[model samples]
Target: MGQRTFAEWLERDMINAYIMSPDSALSPLFLVERQKLESMLLGEQIKNIITCEEVDRKERHEKLEKWIRRLEMTGFEKVPLSYNGRIEATNLLQRYSHKYKFKEEHDCLLVCWSDRPLFSVSAWKFRR
Candidate 1:
């Protein structure tokens, strides 16, 4: 009849049986949704809702800046530019070329890694 706390919902539904660990970080959207549900149970209006993707993007952006700063400070021969999305990679390659300059002849490389060991390192050269 009333909204439940996350703990209450978990206990009532016995959700712990399926989770790897309850201590794992929950997405911001989950926290917001939980708060909204709790508020609704207490007869309050829902104020806002946000997706987990937005939260993850913002966090990843912050991490990218930190990495860039660290790489710059350590005087790497080439700064590493990390991107989580295709759009971000495209925009950076277009607008920030001077900062992330690569040789026109060897401008792109792709590295793939997985948990298994029998993998080959693939490289690609892109013409600007």
Candidate 2:
């Protein structure tokens, strides 16, 4: 991301997939923008994205096996984070920020658990 915009990166097919934390912010344009950046990709028009909100449920434990299978099939990435925002993400965030030259809240803004990928975060230490 040194000289590339988010949309430009997608346009050039530099990133195949990315891991995102639901705890971070997100927006619908994150995915929809892909179509805009890469006009060539729009021809196929296949839905390759899956959101956690679509699968979240209270009674899914009864179907644990199927749920696990579906989740595995979807290849969702698990990001660890704390509610207090005190988790140690130096190594993780630093690498991305340095590569992307992200500054201030924009770095934080790039990771979250929103619907459309405003940003991404991960919790590696523990879970709440």
Which has the greatest lDDT? Answer: 2
lDDT of 1 by residue, 1-128 (tens): 89898756644333222222222257989866764565454321111111235544332222333544554566543423343443464456456332332222122222211211211222222323
lDDT of each: 0.36, 0.37
- Runs of candidate 2 exceeding 4 Å displacement: 1-46, 49-87, 99-128
Model 2, 57-107: lDDT tens digits are 222222333543454466643343443453244446555453332222312
Q: What TM value does model 1 have?
A: 0.17
Model 1 CA deviation exceeding 4 Å by range? 1-61, 79-128
User: In angstroms, how far off is 59's CA in candidate 2?
Assistant: 20
Give Cα distance to truth, residue 108, candidate 2, Å. Answer: 11
